[model samples]
Target: MSVSPSSPVRNPWIVLACAATIVTIAMGIRQSSGLFLRPIELELGVGREAFGLAIAVQNLILGLAQPFIGALADRHGAGRVAAAGAAVYALGLILASQSATALGLNLTLGFLVGLAMTGVTFVVVIGAAARAVPPEKRGLAAGIVTAGGSFGQFLLVPLAQGLIGSFGWRETFLIFAALAAAIAVLAIGIAGRPRQQAGISTQSFGEALREASGHSGFWLLNGGFFVCGFHVAFIGTHLPAFLADRGLDPAVGARALALIGLFNIIGSYLFGLSADRFRKKYVLSGIYFGRAAIMALFLSVPFSPLSATLFAAAMGFLWLGTVPLTSGLVGQIFGVRYLSTLFGIVFLFHQLGAFFGAWAAGLAYEATGSYDLAWTASIALALMAGLLNWPIRDAPVARLSMEGAR
Candidate 1:
């Protein structure tokens, strides 16, 4: 379905803050998986491909579950859905820590955690934020929540690296489990039920879904976002290993990741404000072009600590900048009536790209003995994504246009 109307939350800012916090906790733990990769491999003797495959599975499952879970949030309330997911998230982390086999990793890290993330991630939390605030503020609100995820990555990735160094991977995971469990308490603070604006023509979920599916712009949005997912998942999951291949220190990779997260905070915020002020499709186009340029620059130079740090900072600022603009376009064109569901479907395409990004990079590296081919593909994909977003018409659907006509 498409974006929906409004909600009855007392203070919209409170809802925005709580939703952002939930995103921070949930996404932070998820981003740290890469930090666990080398340690888990060294300890368990799991090969990189096997681990990468499991991580790919996690992304696929997360994408697959979003539309369904988002629907549940829209119907039942984001708070309840988030609370339940947090329980599952903590359970998944705990079990993942205990796992010794690849199959166990698939079940715990790939499947369960992936499933739980759908409940707490952008589709649910940002959707809640969208409905809670006035329409004019939705882009900034979505950006704020999206930034929370980046902040978490910035804050937690380094913390996780330190914990992994000091406490060991298993114990570090247990500590993360405790952090994930806190999402439930925070979920209680988000908006519970979506409320219809009085006298406004309300759209059913199916109607919104149909409207979105029929729109050409929606599919273009999905296409562009798929590229975003591929870029983000590939770099986030594999950059550490890529740096290590250049004979750099492991801590360097962690710092690079944290830098990406840190810079992304600025990126998400600036992109959010830009979406509000400019043509969202144009903003999205620029982001994709920026990503292509950054990657190209990273490859042209020697792989050194300074270069890697600079690359991460450049890449991070472009990271997830697409979230607010893409989701904003959905609400802008379709109306915020069923935003969670429509955006969830769009997110599925993103996850498909993520699955391939994570898995394909590993396969390429394993077969070619370097990530050169993957790097080549990433650059090409970014250029193509920029093209995809350039022509997206942001006109509202007939339903929304007609409603406004009244």
Candidate 2:
């Protein structure tokens, strides 16, 4: 890979840094919403399933919109899409504040916010970062950007918890909306004009999808990511409640989420760097297996604040660590020509898992009066994800190379 040494040394790094900042701020507040679930349900007089369903809707809508918005960004520019998304997201929060029913809240908070997330979150931001860096450094660049979201998790979860304790959940959301609006400026900086031609013009988006659809490796990657969504969404939406049920303080849940975010900073970077140096599929396999072992350990031990925090920290290291490696593999196998779209397709699988994870946890807990089955299912799925990754051939598929040659 040839390094493109531009006359200016600082420009590339600055662009990457800006992208990271945007991802961090947006993801931090968004991920922290899990901590708000219990408080909101209590104050608003709603059931756990209702709030859970809203968040599930949010995740599903976001997943559905991601590929389309990512494709738009790939075709057009990230800046305008991000700007529009931020505005919609802020408005969703405002509308959520006035909601009198689950249906109203779900439409505003879940659908609108979820759709907005497509532009502000990883697929768009990381795709931009991937294009900004030199070819050889794309994996590291992707890691740096994704790690920003983890950093946001570390900082935002605790902050949101404190805000909720001091003010109220509704007020907390309003404040978060303000913060989201402020972060939109970073999106503007990153939303450079789209590159019209990146040397893969002959291959249309459909062709790219068709190529990936034919490859068994793509399906394996997608399937494994489904497990990833299940793990993260289940924990994010329910972990706070789980802790409260276990007789731990709500703040402990907040801190646990924070710790997961903090440690993932290290995990994402290390895994991303390793992806460049080692086989990405193997690194992905290890991450999924680690999640399985960690979840089992979390459930096996007596529930305590310390055990919960430890579990979160361990899981955090594995959390979103999948992003850099998976995105890197897509880039390696196909090139960055239609990265946002391909990766968005991959994310749809993740969000589908999220929908089930969020909804099932609530339904199961309500019925069985326990989260044990959900935890056990997560463990089993994690192990399956590990197995799925083990067999993926990360090298470029023949069809892609053949098209490139032509």
Candidate 3:
């Protein structure tokens, strides 16, 4: 439970602060990109499907690169990896500002931004933050860090909307590019050697992979997380457009997104505390089930600004609430040594679902001119995810268990 004298971070709070700041910048900018969809499409005279595909590509690349990026963080240090990612992220935004074609957008926004995100986002930040704290406090620590992203969402979405309304999307991109550069400086605070657990065996990276691969719970966790990606990506990417399609003001969508982010701060922190007290799988199941119910209600009711805000608030409370619990479960079962790599593998599945969610929603809207199919699909997937988590055995792995017994 004690940090070694040689550890770079003598205080866990410093690590949390640095990781939270990095996420605040990286995720804030990334999540707000959806607000640019209509502006970019209108300016370039491109179709929604094309722009959506670009975002979809971004999500796919982000997911695909996570495992490798996470492994790099595991092998090297999170601070350096995250700092490098910040540079890539900033460069990507700058390049994206000048993109005039779908291919250019795809490369800069999708591939480059996504690659940068792999280092700065949850897999690296949360994993590193979790390692800095004691085992008992990992869930709450992860929750506090995950809430940083929600705080970004709350703060940035509205700001991005206003900036786009005034300065144009390209100018806004330039502004965000500058902010991305700041994340590199914050990464230095979290940079350090991995903390060593007292009793856990020193498993090789390959050995850790083999252990996770053989565990049924690991796959179940991945399955449940897939739904998380779908819900968040679809809503984040399309909600503004969806509101506009319903004849609502565009500001309504931005406000709704901000509300979701605001409430998610509370949800993430509370759920993280809950995970420390209850079974993590049960907490995850409850979150997925809540998402299904909330989505269904949002659809069945008449469309109004009030309804949208209410839905946003309700959904926000459930949003990102799963993150700390899911990551905590991984640490509980697998120990924290290779957490970045293992969680990255699980996150890849989440991103795969994200790819489908963002891309398919666009495709469906373009074809049918409605998001009915995507909404219904999300509801069904939420239920499925809830079921998937219910049966997971929330226990320490054999190595950790044996070590504890000794």
- Stretches off by above 4 angstroms in model 3 are 1-8, 195-201
lDDT of 3 by residue, 1-406 (tens): 4543224477788889999888888888888977999899899987878888888888899989999999998888899999999999999999999999999999999999999999999999988888777777888888898899999999999999999999999999999999999999999888976755555556788889999999999999999998999988899999989999999999999999899899999998898898789998988999999999999999999999999999999999999998999999999999888889999999999899888889899999999989999999999999999999999987897788787786
Q: How well does each candidate superpose onto the true structure, as a TM-score?
A: 0.98, 0.95, 0.97
Task: Evaluate all candidate structures by whole-model CA lDDT and list the values in order.
Answer: 0.89, 0.84, 0.90
The deviation in Å at residue 11 for candidate 3 is 0.8
Flag the better candidate by lDDT, 1 or 2: 1
Ten-residue region with minimum lDDT total, candidate 2 = 1-10
What order do you get sorting by TM-score, best first?
Answer: 1, 3, 2
Q: Comparing candidate 2 with candidate 3, which one achieves the higher lDDT? A: 3
Which residue pairs in candidate 2 collide? 79-191
How far does residue 283 in candidate 1 sit from its true spot (Å)?
0.7
